[model samples]
Target: MGIWLGALRRPLLRALPTALGVVLLNFALLQLVPGDAVDALVAEAGSATAETTALLRERYGLDQSSWHQLGDYLQHLLHLSLGYSPRYDMPVLDLLLARLPNTLLLMGAALVISLTLGVALGTVMATWARRWPDRLLSSLAFLMYSTPGFWVGLMAIVLFAVQLGWLPSGGDGTVGAELHGWERFTDTLRHAVLPACTLASFFVAVYARLTRAAILEVQTQDYVRTARAKGLHPVRVRLRHILRNALLPVTTVAGTHLGGLLGGAAVTETVFSWSGIGRLTLEAVQAREYRVLLGVLLLSSLLVIVANVLIDLLHARLDPRIRAT
Candidate 1:
């Protein structure tokens, strides 16, 4: 337990500074943008009167200087206040939390699917080495890696939702119908299939390549050779020695990419019309909702930091050398 706690200390300490930087940078950059959220709301409502604008500005403290606003925002942060979303007319934290679960569900499913498929394909390619099967899988992985996520999502929707008339085109679940129990669960899964596949494809490609390379490298290690020399079964040597160490790198990549999947799937979310943070972010950007956008950025940065810390812990647990260090 002490060892695990020790392993986490440095990364957690580093995360504090990273999170502070994200907050400062996001706040300052958004301040530099041309207009405030009040201008957006007034324009949308077609009530651009000076009095109304002034009142809205005053209400949200937009009338303050940038430095004062920054101080206020930092104060709000200290109190766990994410400020209000002028567009939604609600607490920004609440708005973000409401949409967070959907995003987590989507990204989680995609990550699982991608890791499973990537590892399986990678294992096969490694086993095959230079065979036709390996070549074919490698080529396919490259294609998936190069293709844009949104385009893949669009194509999948066209083929599965429109062409085959299977699966809902987008959204978390069917909107009008009341569903319960297994039915609702299956409906959600059905809706998630296309978007999840679209988002997972690129990750799948990345992991497959990473896994293959890692395995190939691990296979040449002294321990692996020693295991083989001990008359262990080929499968046992491969699984217990080579594959285990190979997965260390794969795990690191997965952890790093998990952050990206969580917050950077804006294109896939938009293409699928999924009501995730990415989509909400898109909406916020279009409407110029600075507070909400900043809140999202802060949350995303925190998640990435948390993910990295967890990855370090996992690494310590998996590799004895890491714990010793």
Candidate 2:
């Protein structure tokens, strides 16, 4: 256990600086944009006198030079205070915290669906050889992987929501419906079906293909044949040896995909018209809500960094070969 923990220490320590660099880079680019958050508010406020605009700018420290502003921003970040939102008129961290759970629900559901179905389907294909199930599932998985998430989302809405009236068109739950316990869950699930399916379909394809290839390769190794030759049942050989080795690569692939899942959720949310962080991020961009954009970028970068570190640890555990490093 001590050795295993020691192996993880260096990788995590290295990832910290890389994540910080990403946050700083994103902050720098956003600051370099043509205007700041104060200007957007001034423009939207329209009739505001120049004096009022000047006061607002000073109040928010937008009056500071680029270097001073960045320094202040970094100071606030160090304290875990993301600052206030000019548009939302609330604390940045509070706003994000409120919306994060909803976003997690949508993305989390899709991830769950993808991992379960993708692994099972992939294992089935690799184990079944040229059977009809393998051929059919492979073809379907290919189609899903090729199709765009947004396009798939739209098709689902048009077919199931609009045409068949099977689900709500968009947005959060109805008036008092969300106030009820299970009712909210049911409502959210119905609304989530299209978006989740759209997101999961592609992931399912990617994971299935990756797992199938990994398993197929592992199944042909000399040790695997020896296991079979030793009179172990075919199922036992495949499950204990082939599947275990195949999973090592799958764990790595899944870890790599965590970032993509967070990023891709934006497109899925837009298509489904869900009010999750992805949708919030889109609205922030349209409104030029600089602070909100900053928050989203920071949160995403941090999540990705955390995911990569976790994946590295998992990879080491799954494959003892990594321990030699």
Candidate 3:
């Protein structure tokens, strides 16, 4: 209600300025690139006539001053009218909307797998920290985290798709693979395997380490000591008391990792040719399709903002210390 809104006001206000900054910085960097959209179109058109260049420039409002262009760009951004795409010859937003689900699917599936497996492994390690299994799992996490994304992706493709003949090699579902409703759902999931595992392995490693550390810290706290002294079963004490309290920091870290997983996993998508935001961004870069590139930046920034906000809420709920003004 009003009380929660009051509590959230500061963070919400901070997000506005952060969003504006991201847009401004992203637009400014694009403007600073070596060529303009008009230049790109003209180069591709193969004609250097004055009339044609002038028409092209005017079509995109490039004749305006830098400040004017920036202001206009911001205004369009507010309306979600991200302008036309030079390469695709369609609205930038349209192209992004078309491609967003594929990327989200890949990243989302990977995140779920990584977080689940990671928490399980972490709990086991924390439950038996001094055992050989704990040491072995820790070593494995370290190795997985250190391995490069591309290398792992390539290996998975080689082994799973080519060597074992288990999954498709790359790209979306098979040619014309009924990409709609329930059928496409399963198809996309099937093709998403390599990219997801490539992306998830590193995250699993990081999350396992984080969760293990958090659990270990909670195990040493005074309440945990009291729980042990009481007649409560060890499993119940660990799960309901120690583990729950330890999850606050781990939740915050995992939230941040989730954002990084989506953004940083660009290389994995590119390697797998999964047609996600990462792949879109690469295509935009190669073609100098600045609008699509800007859209990707906006999308990523929004994701990061949303993730941080969710984490803050989760953190506040978990730790009463966050409720203080």
Candidate 4:
């Protein structure tokens, strides 16, 4: 209990400085973007005189020095203010919060599907070893891993939604349908299938390969040999002794892949028209919505850091040897 508590504490303590660094980095990089929200708005409003543009810049404080802007941003951040999105004419944080749940739902579903299916298929392949089933699984994993996510999403929409009319092509739910109870639940899921599967494909391949390798490595260990020699059932030996130990690497890999998953989700979200952070990011980039972009990047970086810290704690729990280190 003490160890577990310590594990949690250490990460929380370390996260503060790391988060501040992310904020600074995101702010600095956002400044490098080619345009600003004022310019975007001005362009959209048609021809603007020099004086009008100057007033617009002054109104938004776009005339301030970069360093001064950073200082103001940091000050506001201390009070949990994410600043306003001039493009959307709202608080940046509110805009993000609105879309956050959708992104989380997509990412959570994809991760669960990938990890569950990958582990199962990988275990089957490892058990079968050099058999045809193993070869087939390996080939599928390779193919999925090599394919691009957006392309897969487009093809899936074309086949499943457009041609077959099996699933809704895009959006969070059925349009104009005041769905209640089960209908509402299923409708969201129905819309999620293509996007989730598309997001999970590459990750499924990753986890499968990792699991296969880890299981094979664990199989050769003396403890596994002992379990087999002690007359344990083959199933018991594989499940209790082999798979448990093999999962450590999979957990680590999953943690490492979280950021990539978010990145891919952006592409997938755009392709599927999902109203998630990824799509928001794409729009922000195009419109040069600096505050929104920075907020998204900072939030994403923080999530990745927190996930890695949790993974480390989980690793410690799974293998006490890590706690000692």
Instruction: Provide the RMSD of all predictions against the true structure, rounded to 1 decimal.
Output: 1.4, 2.3, 2.2, 1.5
lDDT of 4 at 318: 78
Query: Judged by TM-score, which candidate is best?
Result: 1
Q: How would you encode candidate 2's per-residue C-alpha lDDT over 1-325 as one tens digit per residue?
A: 8866877788678876876787678878887778767677777878788898899889878788878877887788899988888789998899989988878888778878888898889999987857998999899998998898888888888888889998876765654553568877787787777787787888999889888999989988999999988999988997888887888877777777777887788888887677788888888887777778888888877777776677777767776787667
Model 1: pairs clashing at backbone N, Cα or C within 3 Å:
none
Whole-model lDDT per candidate? 0.89, 0.81, 0.82, 0.91
TM-score against native, each model: 0.96, 0.90, 0.91, 0.95
Considering lDDT, which of the candidate structures 1 and 3 is the better prediction for this target? 1
Which residue pairs collide, candidate 2? none
lDDT (Cα, tens digit) per residue for candidate 1, span 1-325: 8998898889888988899999999998998889988888888888678998999899999999999999999899999999988789899999999999878878889989999999889999998989999999999999999998888988898899999998889998999989999999898888888888899999999999999999999999899889989899999998888887888999899988876796557888888888889999989998999999999999898888888888898888778898999
How high is the lDDT of residue 247 in model 4?
Answer: 92
Task: Flag clash pairs in model 3.
Answer: none
Clashing pairs in 4: none
- Model 2, poorest ten-residue lDDT window? 171-180
- Once fitted onto the true fold, the runs of candidate 3 whose alpha carbons sit more than 4 angstroms away are 1-7, 41-51, 320-325
Ranking by TM-score: 1, 4, 3, 2
